[model samples]
Target: MATSISPLEVADCEVLHAIEQQAHSHPWSLPTIQSCFGGLYHNIGLYEANEIVGFAIVQQVIDEATLMDICVSPACQGKGYGKQLLKQVLEQAQHRGVKIMMLEVRASNQAAIALYLKLGFTETYRREGYYPTESGREDAIMMELTLT
Candidate 1:
């Protein structure tokens, strides 16, 4: 399996959105994904055999970066690809002089929460009824990692 991580361009938005739809229950719209290009955003793609398997979107503002989104193809999940992608993103952010990384995850997503914890992120707080759910709204756990 030939795998590589590279910076992603706006041209890859369709692919990113497709993977997002596959991996998330309520994925971001294509327009939303496309709008992340340029400026403060730094996106990366995880490819295997020259095909995209996962991706992460991060936005930096001075010393802080927010992990806006990350998703691995459902077909490629549970094989450590998500962790690999996140690790690469974190490294890149730190190299770019970012002092802190932050992200929000659905409170119901135990797998993602565990992954974040393994990556050294601590729960800072929670926003009640932050994300919409089938039944109603769900809380969003805010996690942060101090890279310095």
Candidate 2:
């Protein structure tokens, strides 16, 4: 499968929303997703044969960058697309002189935490009850990768 990564724009929000809904238990509202199109945020889409299969949203401020969100289509999960997409984001951030990359993940998301760890991120701390869950609230594990 021929795959590619490309910068995404506001026009791509609907497609992103679709994938977000499929991949996340509590997905962002379309308007919330739409608000990330510009400014300090740089969004990217992962495509296979020119069709979007995943996406990531990252925000940069000076030397620090935060990975705000990432998702691969449920059907496309476990194929390493998430890793590829995240690696691309890291590369782009490094190219722009970003010194550190940070992110927060649900404590229950072992797959995501493992992926982050594999990419050199180290857990820094945790926020208890930071994310709402069906049962109650879940902790948010904060991780960071030093790029410089």
Clashing pairs in 1: none
Q: How well does candidate 1 score on lDDT at residue 111?
A: 93
Q: Score candidate 1 by TM-score against the native.
A: 0.98
Question: Distance (Å) between predicted and true CA of 117, model 1?
Answer: 0.4
CA lDDT scores, all candidates in order = 0.95, 0.95
- After superposition, which runs of candidate 1 have C-alpha atoms over 4 Å from their true positions? none
- Per-residue lDDT of 50 in model 1: 93
For residues 85-135, what per-residue lDDT tens digits would candidate 2 score against the true structure?
999999999999999999999999999999999999999999999999999
Per-candidate TM-score against the hidden true structure:
0.98, 0.98
* Residue 13 in candidate 2, Cα distance off native in Å: 0.3
